[model samples]
Target: MTRQDISELYRGYIDCLNRQAWPELGRFVHQEAQYNGQRIGLSGYREMLENDFRAIPDLRFVIDLLIADPPHIAARLCFDCTPVGELFGLPVNGKRVSFTENVFYEIRDGRIAQVFSVIDKEAVRAQLGNDSP
Candidate 1:
């Protein structure tokens, strides 16, 4: 996997996410892709995306920085969206929030096989206000 290829894959993946096109996500991930440390098959991944989009209609990923090496890439993605429904059990209706995450990905055969992400959960909770711990 070359850096350019990985970068392009990520770009398309982000595009799919932005468009909420869960089916297109299959083009970039393995059959057994994982998210949030959970082992999710491609169908499960699609379900998760659908659920997220249902909850956050305006969800998007802003690519602030991307550092790549063959077979791996680390990204600093700026996330922004408004909750149109409940998230983490918080009934925050249309509340806009912004946060960032550091995501490290490992690619195999030009597909993202694994990933690790660190989200600003505390900030998310703070944005959640009374729902926050």
Candidate 2:
């Protein structure tokens, strides 16, 4: 796929996430998609996403930057979420939190097969008052 094609796929994927369209995300993820150092298969990933959405309630992913090359895409993404329940051990319920993450995607055959990401987890910690916000 050309860079444009891959970029659109990335956009669609994020859009799906923003919409909480769990099934739509599955359509673009490979059987085995690596996430956060774990090889989470499609079903596992879906369940994880559902759990997170249940906690956050209102979650949106914004693409700050997107770059596509053969079989890989680099994205700087901003996630805005409202805490409706407990997450990461914090009961920051009904509050809003915004965080940014950088994720690298390895794609093949128009499907995302792997992802590596890093976020300012410390910032998240602070937001929940576990650290200085």
Candidate 3:
């Protein structure tokens, strides 16, 4: 895929997530997808996303930055939502928080094959008034 094609594909994937189109995820994610080095297949990936939505009812993925290079993509995804309970082990407790996640993906056969993501936990901690990192 060209750079533009990859970018468009990623945008579509983000849109699918925003729409909670679980059934359509396979179009973007490969059957053998890996998340953070864990060999979680497409079904596990869907389950993880479902759990995320359940935890944060108003969860929305906003792309603050996106760059596509052939079979690779790097994105900064921003989120502004309230979690029903603790998030990333932090006591968000239904409080509204805004944070960003820096994620990278490797595309294989025009689908996401590998993912590495890091969320801004310090930002959440700061918002929660917790100095301890």
Candidate 4:
């Protein structure tokens, strides 16, 4: 896929995620996907997302930054929501917090094949009443 094509595809993926359209995930994610070097495949990926939604009912991925380079995509996903309990090991406990997640993805065969993600735990901690990193 070209740069524009990949970028559009990623936007579609984000839309799907925001909509929680699990059945349509396969259109953007490969059947054999890997996340953070672990081969979770598409089902695991969906489950992870579902679990995230369960933890944060108002979860929504806001794209603060997006960079697409053919098979690679680097995205800064921002979130502003309240977690029911611990989040990123922090005691959020339904406190509203805003954080960013830096993620990288490898697209293969026009679908996401691999993903690497890092969430801003410190930001969440700060917003949750603890400033210490």
Candidate 4: clashing residue pairs, number: 0
The segments of candidate 4 whose C-alpha lies over 4 angstroms from its true place after superposition are: 131-133
Rank order (by TM-score, best first): 3, 4, 2, 1
What digit string (tens of lDDT, one per residue) describes model 4 on residues 6-93? 9999999999999999999999999999999999999999999999999999999999999998789999999999999888888888
Give all candidates' CA lDDT scores. 0.81, 0.82, 0.96, 0.94
Give residue 115's lDDT in candidate 3 (0 to 100).
99
| Residue-by-residue lDDT tens digits, candidate 3, 1-133 | 9999989999999999999999999999999999999999999999999999999999999999999988999999999999988998899999999999999999999999999999999999999999886
Against the hidden reference, what TM-scores do the models get?
Answer: 0.86, 0.87, 0.98, 0.96
TM-score, candidate number 4? 0.96
Question: What is the per-residue lDDT of model 2 for residues 44-130, given as tens digits with 9 covering 90 to 100?
Answer: 888888887888777778899999996899999887788776656667678787778899989976799988888766667787778
> What are the per-residue Cα lDDT tens digits for candidate 1 across 30-97?
88887768888688878877887888877788899999897888999997889786666666688887
Please give the lDDT score at residue 38 for candidate 4: 99
Q: What lDDT does model 2 reach?
A: 0.82
Task: Pull out the clashing pairs in model 3.
Answer: none
Model 2 scores a TM of 0.87
List the RMSD of every prediction in angstroms: 1.9, 2.0, 0.7, 1.0
Q: Give the lDDT ranking, best first.
A: 3, 4, 2, 1
Q: Candidate 1 local accuracy as lDDT?
A: 0.81
User: Residue 90: error of model 3 in Å?
Assistant: 1.0
Give the best candidate by lDDT.
3
User: Which stretches of model 3 miss by more than 4 angstroms?
Assistant: none
